[model samples]
Target: MSKIAFIFPGQGAQYVGMGKEIAMEHKSAQDIFEKANESLGFDIKKMCFEGPEEELVKTEYTQPAILTTSIAILSVIQQNGIEADITAGLSLGEYSALVYAGALKFEDAVKLVNKRGKYMQEAVPLGKGNMAAIIGLDRKEVDSIIKEAQDVGTVEGANYNCPGQIVISGEINAVEKACELAKEKGAKKAVLLPVSAPFHCSLLKPAGERLSEKMESLNIGSLQRKVISNVTGDYIANEKDIKDLLIKQVSKSVLWQDSIELMLDGGYDTFIEIGPGKTLTAFTKKTARKLKKKVKCYNVENTKTLNKLLTELG
Candidate 1:
């Protein structure tokens, strides 16, 4: 028997007009957007649909907006009787995965992510921190370089995206040092990412601390579908663990590559990325190719993609 996994995309996946088509076509999708707006006490819909891209990209607005849009598209998928055996997400996308798994209420998730984004942004001063992508480097080799660069300043592995692609984050000096060293260490390319803050590094510990305090005030429930955690690359089964993981995730490397491997180990052969952009899909293809496994991956961001996925899956 084949199992399907529903994956959600993170920050870089957001665009000006993401889920507008789904919202206009499906009442379920529209309801998600409406409820998110009411819960967030702002018009996130407008920000997503009519974004002055710069304003929409603010951490506070971007986090909740992307979560809501992903869930809106997810609601449409679920309404059409498409469901997943397991779910996972990247960075901010993890909250969307939790919402789909029934581990969190959509209203609470929107509010929490809004706060999460703010805390994350405020954790480090602008331009003080940086993140970079090191392509064509093995994970172990990149980890070694990150450790070696620590002498210059704080540096840590951020996202283990795929077999040959890893993202590192830390102080600007440290990140630059790592980039220079990475190229010398046989990496094809090591370039700074266009991000305001160094996410998923020790530098973001302050953000994690603030998120922990805020998480205590929310009401989280047990999940119906299995949800993979970014911090552990393992299944989060309880509410307490879920809360702890979300807090830890702020400053810990996202073990996305490991998480996908674990999903495959659990017998999932098909992955459906149900959100905006094809970021996760691109990574999935890379991972599958590296593993020499023929996996089915689909990306459903609009009605056309959704219909095609439904037909293919059927």
Candidate 2:
């Protein structure tokens, strides 16, 4: 049996000219950008195709932009009759997974993530919050190290990205201290990440509260496909749990590695990174390696990638 999982990339994966070629080739993909523009009341298509980099990188813009481009690329994949048996995504990328699952409509997702991004940025001041990547270290050790440095501020593991890669986020001093401590603790590398806010940590609880209010107004539908939640890294239980999980995801660690592991354990043998960047592809491959599971990985950000996927999967 060949089960496929479609995973999406999160922030730091966005770049100018992401979905243009896909949009130009597929009318369905083009319609997605047009609809996003109508729902958002701005030309997100232009921003994805022609970005100044400065404006596109803003937290508020980046969330919606990536979600839109993902759905656009998803539209093309659907038209080509390729589908996933399961799906998951990283932090901001979770919204894309929900959309693909039919748990959230594309239009509503774009709007929601737009406000979600703004709330996240406003939750912590620029210099006050920080995030860093601790490579070649285990989460338990990272957690212990972060707990040791809590007095410095409010740092915690934000993203359990892969086997040996964990992202910690919180107050600036705490995060910086944790990084130094990680270096001392024999971590292969401990480096700070360039991000606007300390997302997915307790510091962003206020942001989650804000997102809850916005989520209430939207009409979320039942899942049409299995979707893994970032907070739990497992199958989303039911429709009622969607909004709460999404809200909690704002201030919770993303169990991305766990999510991929669950999929592989459940028999998903193929993975396609459907949005921008091959970051998730790398994560999935690394995770599969650690799990001693065999899997095929692919990413579709442009026509060439799409053609390769279609030729094989179609």
Candidate 3:
């Protein structure tokens, strides 16, 4: 049997009405959403289902909303008897993976992410920091470009998403300079990302430090499933290390491609992205193809995708 891995998406994947259908059709999913409202002391469902896009897009609101929706879908998946051998997620999505791995409680994860989002947003003022996706460039090339661009200001590679695709984040001028330098260096496309803050870059170290202090106060549980750390792109074995890894993840580059490669090399061939968007699924497929590995990819977001996953995975 092919081994299974459950992956979750990060910030940009969220949207209004993401979990509405699942919550309406699945009792387990609904209960998860209800629990989020109780723990959050706010109508997160309303923000997700009937969003004023502006409100929903705020980093503070977006993190919790995405985490709740992902976990809600995860509840339905668990109710169906589906399970994963290993799990991982993109930046904010890592919290969902940790919850799924039993390293943290749902309530605790939701609260932590809400605080994380707020801290990250406040780390750097808006318009002062930015991120850009450098397409059609290998890691070394992008790294070199970033190194050169650093002379202009503080910019560094943030997300090594997949083959030929990496994101850089830092000061706006530095990011723009990197994009221009990348284009001149034969990169196919260098597009500025639509994000509120320069996440996964050194600029967010202050946010990470605050998060570390908050994490030290929590009673994190032992993991039931292996979760790949974005900071290291490796299995996070020691429960004691989870807090530090999470803190470092806020500012370090997300080794998404490396994480997926590690799993695939370990003989896992199935990936199910449990979240709102197909972002992680798309990246998984691309990474697998680049690695010349045969893999199965699926995502569960709504009734349609859930039914398809059930039909196929079963």
lDDT top scorer: 3
For each candidate in turn, the TM-score is 0.98, 0.99, 0.99
What is the C-alpha RMSD, rounded to one decimal, of candidate 1? Answer: 1.0
- Model 2 lDDT tens row, 1-314: 57889999898899999999999988999999999999999888899999979989998999999999999999999988889868898988989999998888899999999899999999987799989999998888999999999987899899999999999999999999999999999999999988999999999999999999888788889898999999998899898999999999999999999999999999899999988999999998999999899999989999999999989998
Better of 1 and 3 by lDDT: 3
Query: Model 3 over residues 36-91: C-alpha lDDT tens digits?
Result: 88998999889998898899999999999999999999999888989997999999
lDDT for 87 (candidate 1): 95
lDDT-best of 2 and 3? 3
Tell me the tens digit of each residue's lDDT in model 1 across 1-314. 66899999998788888899889999999999999999989999999988989988999999999999899999878877888979999999999999998889999999999999999999999989999999998988998999899999999999999899999999999999999999999999999999989999989999999998988877888789999999999998677788889999999999999989888777788999988898888888888787777788999899899899879875
Off by over 4 Å in 3: none
- The positional error of residue 241 in candidate 1, measured at the CA in angstroms, is 0.6
In the predicted model 3, the residue pairs found to clash are none
Q: Which residue runs of candidate 2 sit more than 4 Å off their true CA positions?
A: none
**Model 1 per-residue lDDT at 98:** 93
Over all chains combined, what TM-score does candidate 2 have?
Answer: 0.99
For each of the candidates, the C-alpha root-mean-square deviation to the true structure, in angstroms, is 1.0, 0.8, 0.8
Name the regions of candidate 1 deviating beyond 4 angstroms. none
Give Cα-based local distance difference scores for all models.
0.91, 0.92, 0.93
